[model samples]
Target: MGALGAGIAALGAGIGVGMIGSKATESIARQPEASGDIRTAMIITAALIEGAALFAIVVGLLSNG
Candidate 1:
């Protein structure tokens, strides 16, 4: 069960990252002049979402161990 939960969490994180990348690309394409700003915001958002997933994984490991 622990392994399964962790796997699901990882999948969710991957999906989130993918969505972020897709939107970021779309935004850059739509506004080339603001690509820099959009890319920075995208990276920060992705990092924050991934950080939560990482925290979940860490907590799972500690509990399972």
Candidate 2:
């Protein structure tokens, strides 16, 4: 169960990062001038998502342990 939960959290993190990259690319394409801002925002959002995912994985591992 712990392994399963951790895997799910990892999958969610992958999906979230992918979506963020895609959206950031689209935004940059649409507004070349704001690419810098878009990239910064994307990075920040991805970081937050990653942090949550990491926490979830840790919790799952601890529960199984």
Candidate 3:
């Protein structure tokens, strides 16, 4: 069960990061001049999502043991 939860958390994070990247790419395409800003925001948001996901996965695994 814990492993299942961890897998779900990782999956959710992957989807979230993918969506963020997709939108960032679209935004940059629409405004090449703001590409730097869009890329920065995307990286920051992805990092945050990853951090939360990591925390959740750790907790889930620990709960199993």
**lDDT of candidate 2 over 4-61, digit per residue (tens):** 9999999999999999999999999999999999999999999999999999999988
Q: By descending lDDT, how would the candidates be arranged?
A: 3, 2, 1
User: Candidate 1 residues 1-65, lDDT tens each?
Assistant: 66666777888999999999999999899999999999999999999989999888777666775
Instruction: Please report the TM-score between candidate 2 and the true structure.
Output: 0.97
Regions of candidate 3 where Cα sits further than 4 Å from its true position = none
> Judged by lDDT relative to the true structure, which candidate is superior, 2 or 3?
3
C-alpha TM-score for every candidate:
0.89, 0.97, 0.97
Q: Can you give the lDDT of residue 19 in candidate 1?
A: 96
Error of 3 at 23 (Å): 0.4
Better of 1 and 2 by lDDT: 2
Top model number, lDDT: 3
Evaluate all candidate structures by whole-model CA lDDT and list the values in order. 0.88, 0.96, 0.97
In candidate 1, what residue range of length 10 has the lowest lDDT sum?
56-65
Q: Please give, for residues 1-65, the per-residue lDDT of candidate 3 as tens digits.
A: 99999999999999999999999999999999999899999999999999999999999999997
| Cα lDDT, model 1, residue 4 | 68
